[model samples]
Structure formats: C-alpha cells, structure tokens
Target: MSEGSVRFDSDALQQRILALRGERVMVDSDLAELYGVEARVLNQAVKRNAERFPVDFSFVLTKEEKQEVITKCDHLQRLKFSPHLPRVFTEHGAIMVASVLNSPRAVEMSVFVVRAFVRLRQVLVEHPDLAERLDELEARVARHDNTLSTLVATIRQMATAPTAPSRQIGFVVDPLEKKE
Candidate 1:
C-alpha cells in the first residue's frame, strides 16, 4: 500500500495512549484499529508469536484495571461487557505488533505510532516543571491526613515564596552621603 493510502492522525494516536501501570500504552483495540485489523486478529497474531511479547512489552489488564479504563475512556466502553480482558501494548509492543502483522498498512502506521510515543516523551522532557508539579500533587494526594484546604495553602505559599534580591555590581556613592 502507498504511504497516502494509510492515514493515521498523530493527535488521535496520542489520545489513545494511556498511563497504565506506570507505563504509557495503547489498548489492543486501539492498536488493531490503527493497524487496519480486527482486535481478535491482532491478539491471535501476538499469541502465535508469544515469545516476542514479554511482560514488559505487553500485559493483559486485570478486572480492576479494565473497569478503570472503561470508566476513564469513553471510546473503550465497548469492552465493558466483553468477557476477555483487554491487553495493553507499550511502544515496543506496538512496533512488534506491526512486524507480526507484516502488512503494509501496519508498517506505515507503526511509524506514526512510534512518533506519537516519542512526541509524548519529548513533551515530558521539555516541560520538566509540569512533571515536577504532577509529582508534588501525587505526593500531596497520597497523604491521607492532608485536606484540600491544606494543599491549597501549601501551593499558595510556594507560589508566593520570596526570592533573594540581586546585588548591584558596582555603586560608588550611597544615597545618604553628602556630595561635597
């Protein structure tokens, strides 16, 4: 297939990526759709090449995780009634899926998938302040005793914290000194 034949939106692909189990991953259905194949077909291919997919590369979602995903992502609501738990694929696993499918569409779309993952990584690296803030927020949330008011106060205090004034490089005369 020609490059133009398979069109994948990077933004849409990015939206499909979710932070699950502390790793950024795309659900099997999402990947299957992107690869121009059915979810069942995609899973079958992976099963055939089971050795390629290690725990880190891909993992099946637990019941709790499935429920959480369905609640969080409106698009994944279809899986809510399905008996089988959905599998999630990290960046490496996504690429592997493309290879296993061995189709032109999958190969072409994999490039876009990899780019989306890289773009997310670039975003985190470029805006470290955002990551730091998220970490701080997580820590605050972890503290069971901390109320919302206390968290707000802590943030406000940090925002209003004073910084040291810069010293003048060279000044010969004091304002109070007489000129004569």
Candidate 2:
C-alpha cells in the first residue's frame, strides 16, 4: 500500500462521540472504524483487557438502551436487529483499548483519538461562564415572569369585567307630544 500525507479531521471524530447514560462515549464500531480495524478485532482486544475496562470505562448496552441508541443515532441502526448488544467506551476506556491492542497503528490512532476527546473537552471548558449566564438569564426572566403574568391577568380582567351602566346624556322628551 502506498502511504500518502493525510490530515486527521478532529471534527469528524468528534461526530462519532455520543452521550450515553449521562457519560460521553464512543461506540465500539465507531471506534474500530476510526482506528482502521474491524469491530470484532477491537472487541477481542477489549475482552482480553477486560480488567482495564471497568464498568465506568466501558459497559454493554441493555436491549432497551440499545433500541434507544438506534433510534437516536442514525449510524447505529445496523445494530438494531443484531442479537448482540453493542459496547460503549468512555474517553478513558477508548485509550485503554489502544494499549490493549498493542499495534503500531492502533497506538498512533489512539493519539489522535485522545486529542479529539481533549479538544471536545477544551471547547466545553473554554466556555465555563455559559452555564452561569444561562442560569442568570433564566432567573431574570423568571423574576419578572410573575409580574408580567399579573399585568396580563389584570388587563384581561379589565377587558372582560362588567362596565357601569351609562346615564342618558340628552334631556328626555315625550315621543307622542314634545314641548320645548
């Protein structure tokens, strides 16, 4: 095979990442595709180094969770009908897979993968005030929300409220015989 200069697209790798069960993760198939290996090979490596991959590092999806993922991620639809449940690896577990594989290519790919995860994290960390600002905005909106609601309710009540009966403006004159 001829080797040519190729650039790693961190953005593309980031797309494969997912949030599952409240943790950011990469599915086994996606990780294998990224590492240029068969998914089975990657799974084998993980099974061999199962100790390194604790529950936090990696976990198998339950049937219901698997269905939920299939519905959420278009790329994972293939696994929807497959009997075997898929495995998911957190940022740390993905790194462990590379060490377990012990291949030159896997090691090199791991560097890029780790960088991708770190890049995603850095992007989030850079905006530490984002959550704070959102909270402040919500509080401000909520603070005035009651006042606004009351004002609207008062206007609606005035509009719908009964009005006082009006008195006759002009002097009364008998219809049958009018006298000035």
Q: Rate the local accuracy (lDDT) of all candidates.
A: 0.92, 0.84
Residue-level lDDT of model 1, residues 42-98, one tens digit each, is 999999999999999999999999998999899999999999999999999999999
Q: What is the C-alpha RMSD of each candidate to the true structure, in Å?
A: 16.7, 9.3
Q: Highest TM-score among the candidates is held by which one?
A: 1
Predicted candidate 1, C-alpha RMSD: 16.7
Q: Candidate 2, residues 46-158: lDDT per residue as tens digits?
A: 89878899999999998888887899889889997788999999989888988888777777777888888898889769998875796799799898998899999999999
> TM-scores for all candidates?
0.74, 0.66
- Candidate 1 regions off by >4 Å? 1-7, 138-180
In model 1, how large is the Cα lDDT of residue 172? Answer: 63
The TM-score of candidate 2 is: 0.66
